[model samples]
Target: MIRIVITGITGRMGSTLLRLARDTADLRVVGATERPGSSAVGLDAGLAARLGALEVQVVDDLGRALDAAKADVVIDFTGAEVSVGHAKACAARGVAFVCGSTGFSPEGLAELAVCAKTVPIVAAPNMSVGVNLVIRVAAELARVLGPGFDVEVLEAHHRMKKDAPSGTALRLAEVLTASLGRTQEDLTFSRHGQIGARPAQEIGVQTLRGGDVVGEHTVYFFGEGERIELTHRATSRDQFGLGALRAARWVVGRPPGLYDMADVLGFQGNS
Candidate 1:
């Protein structure tokens, strides 16, 4: 069995992950953690209404939680600030990390990459298998379509989500930019007012927020007299939680490095 610890135990994803872990045979919840001064600090993680009853408490002290728990992997669904500390602590303790936290700045990502030199870390903005596959397909489409198509990405998330464009949207944009041999800054076009005609080399991104949308992404490829559209919609958070566990299992004994769902799905490095 894979002994696992969860960061962000009181959050929506964390609670959902706890429930999913209960049903998996190869994994066990060894620890759960929230930030200091959190109201959930002393609650039973396994007693979440959706998870019924088990023997795990939501903790606050990162060091104490990991030191007292016999976990082989730590799954982080926390914010980037907290995740940075989690990464450092997990690396120092030689624990594998599966991070689903998003919205990290370039500098924060650089820090995580440096941390990965000491401990294996599997990180993805969106952990759904289908979403990862969409990235592969979108990259191929961008390569084949070249610059003829005016690419626009649309994403919708729940009102409670804090980020704009969604991380998955940004990843899709990254893949498209790479496929077209362009940097994100060179290709991304977000503007208003009397904007000139769309540039041949630019990709546009639009975002929407409403309701309880689990997640949704649509890629539009427009050409003369024709258009191709590719989309992926997530119906629940369980898929993300399950995919994270799958990644955690895959990174169990691997060497220290940065990895993503593409790696988990066995895609080419550049994909």
Candidate 2:
């Protein structure tokens, strides 16, 4: 059986992962962690996740958890800084890591890359299979449609989501820009009145947040006399949780490196 620890066990994604891991074959929840002061820190991870009891305590320190559980891998869904720290801790102990956290800055990502040189790490903004597939399909569409098509990306999430323009949205934009041979300078995050006509090379990204909507994203390709829309709507967080668990299973015993869902899913061109 694959022994695993989960970070942020009380959060939406964490709870789902805990439950899914319990039900999934060949996986065991050996440890779980939450923020140091959170009420969940001392509770049974299964109880905290409303899964009765699975004999795992929720701690605050991931390193201690990893050592105590003799964990094979750690699945983390905490903040960017927290996930980076977890990755380092896992690297120190030679435990693989699967992170589903978003909102990482350039420097934080660089830190993750550095940690990956020591142990395999799967870090992704959105771990849903459909979203990863959309990333690839969007790139292909951009390549086929060419620059004549005006591209715009729109994404929505719950109001509590901290990041504007969800990481998935930015990933889509990144692939789109790459496929079109453009750069970050060609992507527009916002616009104001009297901004003039949209530049031929500009790719627009917009954000929406309100209510309890799980997540939603749409990529539009507007061309003469026709337009194409590629959209993915997530009604629940289970997909992300399952995807992370899938990555955790695939990452163990692998060589040290940074990977994403595309690598786990075996997508050819884009990650």
Best by lDDT: 2
- Clash-forming residue pairs, model 2: none
lDDT of each: 0.88, 0.92
Give per-residue CA lDDT, model 1, range 84-177, as digits (tens).
8899889889999999988898888988998899989999999999999998999999999998888989999999998787889999999988
Candidate 2's residue-wise lDDT over 1-271, tens digit each? 9999998988888899999999998999899999989998888999988999988898999988987878899999888989989999998999999998989999999999999999999999999998998889999999999989999999999999998889999999999999999999999999889999889999999999999999999999999999999999999999999899889989999999999999999887672
In terms of lDDT, the poorest run of 10 residues in model 1 is 45-54
Colliding pairs, model 1: none
Model 1 TM-score, 2 decimals: 0.96
TM-score of each: 0.96, 0.98
Residue runs of model 1 more than 4 Å from their true location after superposition: 48-50
